[model samples]
Target: MRVKDSATDPNAIAVDSPAGTASPRVAAPRTGGGTLLAALGVAAFSLTFPATVWALEGLGPWSVTTCRMVLAGLLAGACLLAGRVRPPARRHLLPLLTVAGGTVVGFPLLTTLALRTSSTSHAAVVVGLLPLTTAAYSAVRTRAGHSRTFWAAALTGAAVVIAFAVRESGGRPTTGDLFLFGALLVCAAGYSEGGRLARELPGWQVIAWALVLCLPVASAGAALSLRTEPVHLTGHAVAGLLWLAVGSQFVGLWIWYRGMAAIGVARASQLQLAQPLLTLVWSVLLLGERLGPAAPVAAVAVLVCIGVTQRTRS
Candidate 1:
């Protein structure tokens, strides 16, 4: 989540040392393509909150969440089948399940429900905390060391986000705020787990397998939700749903994992700092949400804290 310099050289090939030598091989610097791919992934993800709000105009949150996951699962199944990838080993099964539950079920469902009451602008600002959360999860899972400065910056960023949430909710936390907080925590766990898995498997394969693993539950939920809430799909809603299914769920993760694998998670995740601003823009333009003066000021403060966190190291 905290951005760092790329860990390896994408263009470098491993050169064999002398037969008796035990020197480790060094990787070349990463290419510019990795940065571009990461940027594209962030761009796709930035629209998610706003798009969910739009889709909710014509469909219930449960229906929208379930349908999006089911659709994305179908596409993931197709990719796995076409790629002729074998099922993951037993050790990987649990991590894959974590990814499935976190990204496919927890994050989308909670955020969809959250948008029912919270404006996209508020949600976008709150999402500014994701990079810090993701970094914390990654550090914990990997047993990586971090400096006190890093912790200080991350905590400050999180505190700023919490303050913004409180201000937006009139000094009291709303149900939507709780939902969004849950979404943030689960999504951070998923992103960290998926990044670790991407080192062992193809990035797309990791997500595809996770999606396929959750297919049965997602399909059932979609059917049950549809039965309970009659869907009246409008043009805007359809477009929003399609974007969520294809871009946010599938394409974004595919490119994101590739970028993470190529440049390392910390460096690649830095690109996500742009997501809140991009989401705010989408909310204002596409969803016609009005931005208050406090929004920009809070966003800048959060971004500054994030930058500081990214630059500090263990």
Candidate 2:
């Protein structure tokens, strides 16, 4: 689940540092470090949604969400146990829990279920609203000055949804779309809060502890679901599950948190503008989904919104 693009990508820590004339000697190393980390964060983040969709082909969204968090929790916990990283302080528990509950638990649960009925293309289109939602959230908090461009971008994003309904197979979104929308909203809120807190906490510590808190919750949900609905395992399913658990959940988050820490929340969220576009690309490639006439128009609209959000924030 994409949280609002954060300027504080936890992963960017290794890469970026303050420019102080007093620290001239460290400049070269900091620059190199920031560059590498930023690159890695970009690469890792790009794969998350596509990987989620790929995993969905085989595993139920609930199972995928549960397994990914459980495995990531274990992996992160092991690293923490080995002194590779440390846990958060007692006072930080609430924030950590919030991040875990919102991102690891809420977003995945909703997104997975959404994918059950909606096409990945539609999911991407709907998710394109995240930036706008984040902007709207910011508007509520800061009441920042607005512009005509801002409203235009916001309108375009809304247009994407309206367009979808017009072309919608049954002339309306299914129940799953509503579910995904709710999940996406939760995720937007998570991004806002998580990015804010990430400024203070180390990336690994946040993810590790957050996952630790989320593990039992996800596990219990999965187990209960399993009783009523048996998981159908296929070769694709097994591979997708493992991939999401290992790649997106464990490794991807490790880098993501780091990126959040390095840059800051708002700026990092900009990286997410790439995600929906990438999803569109992946859908065409992997799922054989077509873009049709709406493709270019949607692309322009999303890009314009991205620009609007950046300008408004800047």
Candidate 3:
């Protein structure tokens, strides 16, 4: 979000090492390639809710959660071995653990739980505010400052999303909404930390190592869940599970971190302004899930906030 104009922005922060030392700052990519990468990442992520719902059709939420994590971790482990990537340094472990806890475990589990009750379109719109949440986290973690205008737009966006949530549930937030909000918060933390970590290591390495770090616990959870959960695998379910593990969790993350490293977190996050809309389209086209009229309105409003925040971030 530093917008590659780092020299003019005194509040810009370099991605920090765990030893409390700042690493080299990532420069903005000279071409549109970074934007393309980020856009692709957003595209991959937009299908997440639909895919989770598909997986849930045949697999229990617990099984969906743990199985995806296990599969992703093994995939990541293979990538590390194939590339002979070094184990992360001792100082990197804490942040890596944070990444694993937030993205690999917390976000996946929470969103899957949320999907149990929430329609894909509903969940997608609620998650539309993630970029703002992530930007706020990034600013706080890096001690970056934003103008009043930036904060105002962010707040308005949050308020709009909140009102939408209440309206969706007949004046109260649903359990699914609560779980989606939790997923939003945890996933934001994971993303901010991962983007920062990517500055010090390859983007692929950052996510790969984080996924690998979750292997022991994820594997155990998968085993336990599989034993108890009644999984009647169907085409949609198997396809959904594979996409969750490979597309969203691994390949998408790898692409996203690289783009974030190149374009900076806040700037790269701007691409996600389209994600909810994309997800909405997918919900209709792929899942035959219809959305309330308010969904598009809320999405457009949030998009405005993101646009304003992007302009005012400097």
Candidate 4:
């Protein structure tokens, strides 16, 4: 998880093109609006897991994930058509393919599978480790300077969350929890790399190519799953699946990646902290799940960890 701070890199403000109209250039200043928008994106995504779980009662996880991607891809394709976004250059095809597989196909498949056994709370707890995982990956990959205190705090927070989740899961980690954690680690890598690519490529274009690249994989998965387990159609299930496909996947991502491109990955990721908290809220309101007495405790601890990790000199 990263924040999209323009303060760190003035060059990221805009992409200049030959057909451009005259535009003014200036030093990137801090904007509270970016943070606010990022917060909204996180809030939207927080509803995603619980929404998936709720929808999953009727639609299977694979079906749900596939449908979501398919709808999102189509929506993105439409946007591309309307905006006249160009296709990727031949040289860029391979890198785009790699990101498509990692970000769209692999991450969603693993996460949807995880949601099958794990409660929304369980998944949230594991995914809350994303800040640590992302920071570690960034440090190793870029050799970026970050504080030891930040890492220590992130590590401690992750440990505490894991401990609580394990206790909640009856001392044994569920397959779902493990899958969620593993997916977070893998997806964070893709997200970091993809964000780097956004420096040279348009945000929607990257995702458009990725979704196109992922279509075959998603189609194959859908075909295989549908062969044995036909999706039973019910009104509630259909409605839920529609929400997953259109609202969560398509609408949510359109805002998310665009915002990430406009800002920066680190700052964009700061919005991610809201996801777990929103999941908790949705679970309580929609699913009637209780966070028990540990809700406030977990909330405070997580916020502190995020604050610690966010203490960057850059």
Candidate number of the best lDDT: 3
Ranking by lDDT: 3, 1, 4, 2
Candidate 1, residues 1-314, lDDT tens digits: the string is 22232222233223223354332222222536666777788999999988898789789999999899889999999988888888987767888888888887899999898888877756765566777777777776766666787677767766666566456545655568888889889988888777666656677888888888888998898899999987889998998999999999988988787766665565455556667777877877997766556767767876787577546544
Off by over 4 Å in 3: 1-28, 157-172, 292-304
lDDT string, candidate 2, 1-314, tens digits: 22332242223223212342221111112323533454465456445566777776656666678778777778877877887555555656776777776677887778778777876656664555665665455445434444666557566655664464245333555667787778777766666665545555555566677787777776787686656555777776676667666666666666665554554444445456556666666667766776566656766765666566445533
For residues 1-314, write the lDDT of model 3, one tens digit per residue.
22333312323446445567666654444425766777899999988888998999899999998899889999999989999877988877887887888888888899899888877656764565787788778888877677888778777776776666556545644568888888889888888888777766777888899988888988898899999999899999999999999999999988888777766676666567677777877887888866567877887897887678656644
Return the TM-score for each candidate structure: 0.83, 0.74, 0.85, 0.81
Q: Is candidate 2 or candidate 4 better by TM-score?
A: 4
Q: Would you give me the overall lDDT of model 3?
A: 0.77
| Regions more than 4 Å wrong, model 4 | 1-31, 90-95, 167-170
Whichever of 2 and 3 has more lDDT, that candidate is 3
Top TM-score prediction, candidate number: 3
In terms of lDDT, the poorest run of 10 residues in model 1 is: 1-10
Clashes of each: 2, 32, 2, 9
Candidate 4 accuracy as lDDT? 0.63
Name the TM-score of candidate 4.
0.81
Deviation of model 3 at 5, angstroms: 12
